[model samples]
Target chain A: MADHLSEPFKKSAMTNEEIMKTQREMRIQFIAFAFMIALTFLAFIAVGAEVAPPGFVISFIIFLAFIQLFLQLYYFMHLKDKDHGWANTFMVSGLVLSIPTIVALILIIGVVKY
Target chain B: MSETVDVSRGLPAHPERATLEGKNKFVGFWVFLSGEVTMFATFFGTYLGLRNGTAGGPEAADLFHMPLVFIMTMILLTSSLTSVIAITAMKKNQFKKMKLWMWITFFLGVAFLGFEIYEFVEYVHYGLGFSTSAFASSFYSLVGLHGAHVVFGLGWVLLLLIRYNRAGITLTNAPKFYMFSLYWHFIDVVWVFIFTVVYLMGIGGG
Candidate 1:
């Protein structure tokens, strides 16, 4: 078993259906990539063109950032697939914790100055 | 365990997690990544809190060049895609294609790092030193942490490529490559927030 791990294989175990599924997955990934790029561009344009007030633009870009984040995490990272329940749990918890951390730091450090 | 993975049938569709060791690594890496999230959150919080504390030094609005940052964002984003492709190739047992895509990802990472270095140097010349102000210190630490990750990731993939130059699609290396892809994507995730919160907000007059 140990020796087999280091040796190379001549072919893949993927059946024809699995191969077709993988190809389909790749196409979906490409579409996700395109959406991410569009989101990025829109964020940049919003800031560049000054299409709205600074407050509105800031919120808009941050919203776009969140959308990009979901796309990357779900599609690119495969967090949307089955068998990712634990991965999803850990990541979502981390994200939940982050919000309070950021809010506290901004309110306490930036505003309160304690 | 022996019956579960029959090597004579060729590489598995999910080679990375076919073995118990590989499965453990997969889960462990995600745990570590969760910790990294909080770690980076602290830095992000610090930067946001102190961004307005320029203290007579160069501010974000003046120091950041939109075009340069936009280019860097594009480079990093594209590299993320390339690594995704590489991992997809890995799962498909296309060893040569996987290596090729990984190499492409490495070069793109190097290009992104180069721009980051150039951006930092330009900022220093513009008088935004590490100790120039609260903003400067926090900004450097946050962005610099991300840059260090890029450098580390580059070294990692390079070593993997060199060590496994001739080792075809083996179960042992599959998990390693897959984990690297995840790390690379996380870096891009961090950069997403960096650009939106730091660069965009900086130039947007917030």
Candidate 2:
């Protein structure tokens, strides 16, 4: 079984360190995956169960969303890797530029109509 | 070429960022994604502002159902995982597994789109036409644009799979695949916001 499984990785250089690194990454991936699922459930519960105040529920879900997006960018997209400096720079700039625009839009649209 | 291509052993630790070509593509795509960030923020801002301007039509609180959006979120999130697994397979030079996982990601995307279409139809049935009010227009603008991205991503992944089917894992194709995964992850990130700002908030769960 081991011999058969090893065939696919034979074409690549499978050093012990690289293999260990991949194993560690896989473990982290599963953990992140599980945590994301749990977070989703909690968001649903916050709304469905009405355990918290209405205002608090909204903030709570948005906070959970922040965590999920961070994981998606840093872990899944590999943005946290050492070599991703320029990518990091661009993404940060994008975030910075968008915040003011979002706030201006909110102000212009005016929430009183709703 | 100054450097010969190594077709024998596996790729470097960061295969997609290993070569000059790879680095260029990787950095360029991030710049493009940054622009995308601003574009999407505009849409989200518009939607958030106008979400209640229903012109006496159906408001978001009356229109959105949490369960459907929740299911769609789970599907898209799972697709992100599948794409990550595909890249892992690529790092190991396991081309077949990479293809399989990418296909899984594609189909999951297709499923998510299906649900989205259904939701839009249900909304329209409930007197929420795009031209119905300011709220409806912005809703379509924000969420519909995202759906369009999913459609484009599906086509891009399929083209990559077919183009590289018989070529094996070359330096040229590795960066292409890596970029595709990054794009997929970005789509997932956008959905994270959509679920929070749009769905959760619309449902008064926030």
Whole-model Cα lDDT of every candidate shown, in order: 0.93, 0.85
Please give, for residues A7-109, the per-residue lDDT of candidate 1 as tens digits. Answer: 8899999999999999999999999999999999999999999869999999999999999989999999899998888899999999999999999888877
Clashing pairs in 2: A12-B10, B200-B206
Give the per-residue lDDT of model 2 (tens digit) for B1-206.
12343434655555665566777999999999999999999999998888777798988888888889889999998999999999998888778888999999999999999999999999999998989999899999999999999999999999999977866666677889999999999998999899889888888733
TM-score of each: 0.98, 0.93
lDDT of 1 by residue, B1-206 (tens): 44368777789999988888988898889888899999999999999998999999988988888999999999999999999999989988899999999999999999999999999999999999999999999999999999999999999999999999999879899999999999999999999999999999999998
Highest-scoring model, lDDT: 1
Runs in model 2 deviating more than 4 A are: A1-10, A112-114, B1-8
Report DockQ per prediction, comma-separated.
0.76, 0.40
Kindly report which residue stretches of model 1 are placed more than 4 angstroms away from their true locations once superposed: B1-3
lDDT of 2 at A71: 87
Report the lDDT of model 2 for residue B178: 94
